[model samples]
Target: MKNKLAIIGGGASGLIAAIAAARNNPSLPVTLFERNTRVGKKILVTGNGRCNLTNTDLTEYHYHGEDVGFVSVALSSFGLEKTLEFFADIGLLTKAEGNEIYPYSLQAGTVLDLLRAECDKRSVEILCDQYITSLKKINNQFIINDIAFDSVIVACGGKASPHLGTDGSSYQLLTDFGHTLTELYPVITQIKTETDYVKQLKGIKIEAVAEIVAANLTRTCIGEVLFTEYGLSGPAILDLSRIAATNTQNSPVIHIDTMPEYSRDEITAILTKKANKQNGTLEELLTGILNKRLGQVLLKYAGFDLKYEISLLSYKEIKKISAAIKQFSFKVTGVKGFQNAPVTAGGIRTKDFNNTTMESKLCPGLYATGEILDIDGDCGGWNLQWAWSSGYLAGKSAAEKLKNGDKND
Candidate 1:
């Protein structure tokens, strides 16, 4: 086992990395260590169990990092097309919803099963419920709890969703080797606000453009944004959470454009028509236009009495209503934190590793991939794609070095 490869974390990246290494080298041993009771635990719950495997729209805009270009090599090596081909080769057919990709079976378990079966076929050993306490390289031997391997891949993920086995304790492993990590924060998560609108409008779903108005940047995403007791949660909101996390040092502002399709004049015309055609009250004017509770909250947010007839509302009031519809602002208190965050915003700095191979510049024979790296993608399927790409490079790169016996050059 002296030439064997050890991969920490049996999550998305770790599993794929192990498979990639074992399949390429064949004889070189590749073993994965997962602290959870089972591998792919987080994969099972992704995209609400459908498992968003990849996205149709793959671009730099979907990702965030201090150096976003660090992912170029890995991504270019194995992109979305390669990802689909790999999945198809593994016998897991996929279907696309708009740009988002998922298993044709519509079950995350299907994807997981296929991945696990493929890894098994490749002679990859999966050790679950195996917590690696300490990681160190001694006498050219990569050691985890005294067990040694020729190369090690760190894919233990970040401090998001501790229940899924990313307890953040694994970060110490890299820091122990003198790796520099950026300030970690919960991103791709829910945003808490100071407005009572979400509370009164709870359980209502509205299609809107959720915006994060930060110190110097204003990012927006258009999708279904759900109102909750605490704040906003949904696809659009989750995407904007990255901006929120990056600007958390200062109080950020959230603006939701509920009626992105309409202009201010259009809203004014529509409201006037509703008043003249049906003698509609304020609530009635927005009856079909918005969710009932959402309309009322917007009315209140615009400083209108709900019972007032739309006909009685002055032009000034109408303009305010239009502004409220177009720009419902919420003062962001903070993010939902790591426990509730789907992914983390920051991690091991990208400059510390080679993007093409994911090998740590600080520590030779050691590689980092997936959520452990600084690269994080927005909600959709970018994150999973990152896992697959980086994992592939890490495993393949590590295995090649192990086989040729020319590692860390």
Candidate 2:
């Protein structure tokens, strides 16, 4: 009898794993199980529905995990070039914006449709609404809800977006197989600060540099920073929020540079000139330079009354205002949690799985991949890249092992 392969979770990694396994071994039967009503439900929401396919900067530097270097083998096996080619072969055209890549149609649905089409042509059986809760290993063959399979691959993702079908429930199955998990944290989420000033500046959006100092590691990102009632959100904050989420013990602090284009000295000189001319009240001094409300808040935070005349401001006061603008710091209390997080930071420890094959070192014929494996990437399409890379490696390796008739350890 021919071997059968079972893949749990029909997310990005599971879908790609089924395709790779079925495509590599035509005779092998591959079944993909999804808890959701359909597969790729999470794909529809990525990149704001545009579906960021991959990134040009596909390096190990962007990925984080217990053993971040473990990704090198899988990435080297199937990198961006192969990913693009595979998508193209399945009839999906792609476009690139700077370092990020997306579907030419600019619709995430298009990408999902193409992947499903490829799986269909490869005869990969897709079973939806199969909420697999546990697996049994009897005589080296895995049993999923009483169904026997020669090999099993778990790609059920993490707890980042619980509503999207990956609620991190499948982690228990791996733990049942003698695997361990690392401390989990939500990443790519907004930062909740301990300040009342942000509440007054709510709804204000500005291009600024956001820097977070945590665990003695400093990370900075320059983009749009949106002041929310809860705290801060936007591209810049989300990019650096990982550090804050992971380093809660070290007391993370985020500093925003409202005017990145101007140095502290330049801002001081400009403010001094305006004050020397007696341009307007302290409230009106930064009207043209910043949002009126944001400027007012900054001045107030620097201990200046809005009714105070700019001409009465001393050199020391001017320096203080400039310092506030250049380094507006806030104490980071926490993040928005997994519900708002784009991806989870920690997961199953990578040491238990072979990086080249993504197979379990403890349990032969069992494997884990994607966000569930403790390897998460930065915001720029790197997570999906890892899913594809690791999934491809796991599927291909599983198929090869079965083909070789390798006895289970």
Candidate 3:
């Protein structure tokens, strides 16, 4: 008799795993279950509908976890090159924008449609709206939603976007099955500040570098920073918000350098020259150089008169203003919750699963992958790459083990 396999969660990772498993053994029965009436709701919204399918640069530095060695193994086994090849083989051409890879058609729906079509072509069964409330090892078979299978793979994602159907319900279910989970938190989220400067600068966008220093590490990211009524957002701010949100000590302070490429002395010299040539007020001189409201606020914070002419300013005052502009700092009071987060920071601990196959070390015939695992990558397509790589390995490995009649308990 052919072995029966069941995959829970019908998102990106679950669908990939089902397709891969069926491809390995066409006669084996593979069933996919999703809680929502439809699958791939999250995939449709990724990359603003363009779907950053994967990152061409898949490096260890882009991911975070307690078990770095385990993650390294997984990446080496199925890296970015392999992912590109796999999709191309399935008739989905991909293109790279900077470091992010997207479908050639530039529509996320194309990727989703191809995967769904592949599943159909392989005769994989998909059952939507089948919410799996529990999982148990009955005798020797795995049980999910009262259905028994010889093996099961859990691909339920994290709780970052609740509307995407990954509301973190799998964490409790896995814990009940003797798996350990790290304290979950929001990653790639926006930060909120106590000051009202954000409201004043709302709708203004600028390029800046955001630096976050913690007890043991300091990181920096350079990108577009956007002002919202609540606080700071955009790529640069979200990159550092994860660290700030996870720190349990004092609230994290972020330093923003609006002029990242220029030195403080260089900026000062330019400002002095412009002020001397124009004979204009501080506010007037900096009006077009920076955001008008931000310039006024910085001048106020530095105890400089916005109406003062450049020639009237003392050398010491000029130095102080330059320093403030170079090292603008703010304390992050809190981070936006999972509702706005791009990914969850924690999930099933890596210790419970084999990094090679994503199979449960504690429970044979059980596996976990995707955001359900503790592994989370940085913003640029790393998380989706993890989903594809892990899903491929898990599905193929499970099928091979069952085909060989290897049932070690």
Pairs of residues clashing in candidate 1: none
TM-score of 1: 0.95
Provide TM-scores for the models. 0.95, 0.99, 0.96
Model 1 segments beyond 4 Å from truth?
277-283, 307-311, 407-409
lDDT of each: 0.88, 0.92, 0.84
Deviating ranges (above 4 Å) for candidate 3: none
**What shift in Å separates residue 16 of candidate 3 from its native position after superposition?**
1.0
Tens-digit per-residue lDDT, 269-303, candidate 2:
99888788766689898888889999999999888
For candidate 1, write residues 129-241 as lDDT tens digits: 89997997888788886788888999999999999999788888898889888988898888998857889988888888888888888887898999888989988898888
Candidate with top TM-score is: 2
Tens-digit per-residue lDDT, 73-179, candidate 3: 65777778878887897889998899999999999999889889999999989999988978888878888777788889999999999988888887877788789
**Clashing residue pair totals per candidate (backbone < 3 A):** 0, 0, 0
Error of 2 at 286 (Å): 0.6
